[model samples]
Target: MTVDDIDQELLRLLSADGRRTFSEMAGEVGLSVAAVKRRVDRLREIGVITGFTVKVDHTKLGWGIEAFTELRYAGATPVSAIITSAFAVPEVQAVYAIAGDPDALVHLRVRDIRHLQQAIDRMRRTGPVVGTKTLMVLGSWNRDDPAPGPVSDER
Candidate 1:
């Protein structure tokens, strides 16, 4: 439950690249390979490290547009219903139910502007959605990137 400095370092390395070997992590953390493995295993057993994921370039995979749509529900729409409506559209990558004028925000990846419009239309028609405003992403930077720019520095 308590992650120490070394465990945090290991997590940072793994987040940057899930494929990093335990041996490499050991060298970075100044521990033996077996020790590093044991620590990583414990991290998983205690649920600190639930799983690993791969970073993808959607543009390379034919999804050329990424957008975020703010959704406004009519009144008292259940969170489950909001999630269900967004998930029903395959282009939706994630949804956030937040505390604001807009009840939810949906992240989507689509082939083009027309596809984005269609996905947004579906979101409105599926649930108690009363309104939606979409903003196209021109560029993005993630801290999980192995070699990120100056904006990623938290130190």
Candidate 2:
């Protein structure tokens, strides 16, 4: 898709609140509920709108430890193998294959530091078992700051 101004506005509204009703969005975007629905459907069909999900407080869920681990593997060790190993451990939230000294970066959220260590040990044994470096997060401000304004003059 080729998104226009109205489509952008509709997206902005839905992003702020995914469960927002089509009727309410129609009122804000100056379109009928059915028209708005069509546009949203098209967005999903084209893969612009993937899925909706709830944001949770990890601390409240008893998951206190958060860390970033840089992993290096011996030459010829497939990245896919490393990713599969990490995925087997539930604490591994995301895995990024980078283009630097460390071949991959893994994001983890676990019950505690000991839990994190256990996960790391498992992954180390599963993959090429070359080396690893981990940095535990003291704190984070993932959504504390107000986002900046638009870059272009589109608005």
Candidate 3:
């Protein structure tokens, strides 16, 4: 599915704020409401736009503790199995099978230190994970932001 200028503009706008109405988006992108709706529908059908979600505050929701865990697996071990197991645990927020020194990097949010310990213990028991190094998140200086694309002078 090739995305044209209008589609790209729609995506940019939606990425900034997913909750914007179709009519509102149409006005900004200089397209009719129905046309905008059709483009969005097509984008979703082609898997360009997956789904919308609401961002939440983990601290406010009582998940105060955050940790980053790096797992080193055995030689030529399949990391997918480990990742699947990690995702099943409620405390796990994100899992990445990195290419460098560590086999996998996992981000977790827990209610307290005890919960973090339990999560680590469970992961140790899971397949092929030889060792893990965990770092407790004290404070985040920067929040996660999507990579901005190249500047265009279409407008």
Local distance difference test values of all predictions, in order: 0.91, 0.85, 0.87
Greater lDDT among 1 and 3 belongs to 1
lDDT by residue (34-121, candidate 3, tens digit) is 9999999999999999999776888898999999999888888777786887887778899999897799999999999999999988
Q: Which ten residues in a row are the worst by lDDT in model 1?
A: 145-154
Residue pairs in steric clash, candidate 3?
A: none
For every model shown, what is its TM-score relative to the native structure?
Answer: 0.92, 0.82, 0.79
Say which candidate scores most in lDDT. 1
lDDT of 1 at 36: 95
- What ranking emerges by TM-score with the best candidate at the front? 1, 2, 3
lDDT of 3 at 39: 99
Question: In lDDT terms, how accurate is model 1?
Answer: 0.91
Model 2 regions lying over 4 Å from their true place: 139-155
lDDT of 3 at 51: 94
- lDDT by residue (20-96, candidate 2, tens digit) is 99999999998999999999999989988888877678999999889999899989667788788778878889998
lDDT by residue (74-129, candidate 1, tens digit) is: 88989899999889999999999998888999999999999988888888899888
Candidate 3 overall lDDT versus native: 0.87
Poorest stretch of ten by lDDT in candidate 3: 139-148
Query: Which candidate comes out best when scored by TM-score?
Result: 1
